[model samples]
Target chain A: MCDSCGCDLASNNHSHDTDSRIIEVHQSLLAANDAMAARNKAHFEAMGAVAINMISSPGSGKTTLLEKTIERLKKKIRIGVIEGDIETDRDAQRIRAKGVPVIQLTTGGACHLDAAQVHKGIHLLEKEPGGARLDLLFIENVGNLVCPATFDLGEHQRVVLVSVPEGPDKPAKYPKAFISSQIFLITKTDLLPYFDFPVTEARREALHLNPRLQVMALSATSGEGFEAWISYLEGLTGKTRKDNFPPLLSQS
Target chain B: MHEMSLVQALLTQLTSLAAEHDKKKVITVTLTIGPLSGVVIDSFQFGFDILSAESNLTKGARLIITSPTVSYHCVRCGSIQTAAMRPDHCPECSETLLIAEGGDAIILNQVEME
Candidate 1:
């Protein structure tokens, strides 16, 4: 037997004792999630909607950003949200007040939102009043930096946000979130003057992790630098609505 | 943690593999865990040990996990170097801009069943 890979027979299943067979199966552990995510992306396309997954540590302003974004884009484009949390529906309630379709998935104890949960969430979302006609879908993932990055929830774009108080080391400390995300948002820019957060260092480190990550700074509370986010959403809605709108997989 | 879920998925796969090949038992399982897979080897092994004992197919299956080398590609010179841990700087050009490649996989490579 080779000590490195632990293989006695070169070919698979050549043993004289055919009762024991070596099956050569090379597959990723995340394959199931990836496959489901791909299907969910197609489902989003069928709804003529663009989905973006929001990832960040707790209190990094994910829900706040969603609330502010809904306020800005809901007038021009229909918006829906799927909120993931460990215990409460508080975030969904916040979005509900903004007069948009919102569904909450309480993960109980799960750290991140997986594709299977999002599949069910998407179904439940369509039952809401304006869910069927959504132009944008936001999946507000659980607030944890480490675990959520491993799972893909069928989003066209993934945005990772870090608040001003969170400091500039987040991108270096939590590289997975920055690496997997398409957009790196520095939230709570309103507090920048009071805190020691260096925006340039934050942006530079995030860019170091992923050169393609579109880094932006914004304050959801103060509404500073919010237009860029709104425009990004509009751009997604425009492109998705025009080129890839499939037959509406209307939820029955 | 998600390790429990991953172990559940792995057990399910092993059960199906045993059934597909007309094998009653899984003797060994080999997995290649990459550095960036965000999985703790100890936790995964612990999860596997506990969960595999509950199942008939993988009750006594030995789990062998190997971590592949992490390659850091220098953004300056495009030179790739493999190391157990992330290299501090590019050896060729002493640059900090290094792009990682192929260390995020968690793959089930091979299985021995009977």
Candidate 2:
């Protein structure tokens, strides 16, 4: 201690000055991230896109749901996707095949995608055709229920998905995602007859955590309870049903 | 993990702090992680311990974390209750329309350097 910077080592004999100074910083560690998120939100609104952040456990059918949604509304609403994963361009590839602009943000090992990452993602997506102008943007967050719940990626809405195989205890177990989200969509309801996932208990638990959450159940494979979802999207975008879509899009 | 990202953010802040303060080394860092902040304390500490050792300025810096309780005010009765854990039902009126208030912050309170 005495050799490094000429500091006293246990000097108590009438010290002339107290060198220790305490600085009070009442600033948040997340302030930087939040600031970036605010910028991203402004950028999204400027682009006239309603961004939705999707959170769920791994294999909760986020990709499948996106595929179905793109199939239904690709002709009407111009959709763009930003896929966040620990490692993969796979989800982005799927969305790209649907003829919509898509970007992948691989977090390497991080469990979540923050605003900074999305800020970069948006810039990258703009390079693709039709990416510059989007009616709706879907940010598929990394497949983790816990960590991804913490960060906000400047989304207009947050939708938490739960598959039938994930069980009804998800809401009770992962309260942070449900509590923070505005919408909770129960996916893979086609398998409800096989699994013992009680819709009532799941809805009740989520409601207990967040009474304001709008809950919906749908089966993407069976096409059951899909009208509500389709209507919700149409209502969100204020897009009236057109007379006809030009016999378009033979899926690749 | 999310904690690793947070640790990375902390290290970034520390590096800038050391440069700004013209310090050779950091002695201590104080942080406030809220209960509902979605950060696991042990994981964050583990990340900090490992990551901090990699840097010269913060190789031996001590980390102190504090979690403040969140207050919930009932919309029905307007009674406020403070709890680290979410209340199952409102203590005063048994109402479920309780809004969260404060304590949702992850802050770097202070950094001591020399």
Candidate 3:
């Protein structure tokens, strides 16, 4: 108990009224969000799914990559997707057409999706036909590199994408995304021949910032470097491929 | 902007805290934004400024932000450097491979209410 104020302030008796009426809160503003994220994590684990949050700028081929990934792995892997956007259900429409359990979270105007929003989204997705069961859950975060890095949506893996048009300087410019993410994906790599994107430089820069970052470059249209990505997903789900496909080595 | 959502969250927390404490006015709010915490300080302040004006309790309330620096330890020589911004390279060994430690938090440290 607080001695001076008779307030039930736990653990300590330090009073705000004593010194300029300043209170020592020592609490986080994100406490609510963190609690929600923990609940979301438990929910994901209950469904036995590995949740992956994909972050990137707008038009970084996140939606397209999901479409292609679904086409390739939908039969073997049970996949679910949560598409987050500032507005509209357009991305959700795209994912739903691929015949996977999908949910759309419109942030209205926020550039990032927080744990609370994703918590609500998870409950909503469970209402869909195939949402209850999942092998892999893809959380398509709001298409922004900066603000989204600050919020954790209870994802087991975080993949950050940058298209060739966005250039190689992304890792340097937006250090938070690269630093926080476990994987760095160079999307729209088919345009590399025409663009001035130096893949080596991009990888070097990203690795310089975060040595543990697993980097890959792929093109959804041409299917270039998609095998490595597929293998990565398979590895995460603990699925082993019996087919003797040529292995794509990691980029140095 | 995401700042708006963050501001909204802050407001919700503040209002709830005020209600719990039976406080009428908020005097100050102290937030600690880490150097690597992806929130833009200016934008967050701008957001607080705009949204805090909406409520009488929060109106004219002062917001104080403290950004803590993370220590980057050089993988080569094990030298430590504290910086608000990421350094280009290690000053001691000039090595480019340096790992950042801590400073990735966006916390509301304290609030003054009465």
* Per-model TM against the reference: 0.88, 0.90, 0.90
TM-scores for chain A over all candidates? 0.87, 0.89, 0.88
Candidate 1 — what's its lDDT? 0.86
lDDT by residue for model 2 over A55-167, one digit each (tens)?
99999999988988898898889999999998979999998887899999999988889999999999999998999998899999999999888888899999999999999
Clashing residue pairs, backbone N/CA/C < 3 A, model 1: none
What residue runs in model 1 are displaced by over 4 Å at the alpha carbon?
A1-18, A239-252
lDDT of 2 by residue, B2-79 (tens): 888888888888888777767778878999998878788999999999999997888998999999999988878999
Q: Can you list each candidate's DockQ?
A: 0.68, 0.62, 0.61
In the range B1-114, model 1's lDDT, one tens digit per residue, is 677778887888888888888899999999998878778889999999999999788898999999999887898899999887767678899987777888888899999998
On residues A1-252, what C-alpha lDDT tens digit does candidate 1 reach at each position? 544445785655345665887889999888889999999999999988999999999999998788777766666688999999999899999999989999999999999999999999999999999797778999999999888898988899999999999999999898888888999999999999899998999998887767779988998776678767876888888832243322122110
Q: Is the docking of candidate 1 incorrect, acceptable, medium or high quality?
A: medium
Every candidate's chain B TM-score: 0.95, 0.96, 0.89
**Interface RMSD of the candidates, in order:** 1.4, 1.8, 2.4
Backbone clashes for every candidate come to: 0, 0, 0
Q: Can you rank all candidates by DockQ, best first? A: 1, 2, 3
Clashes of 1: 0
- Model 1 TM-score relative to the real fold: 0.88
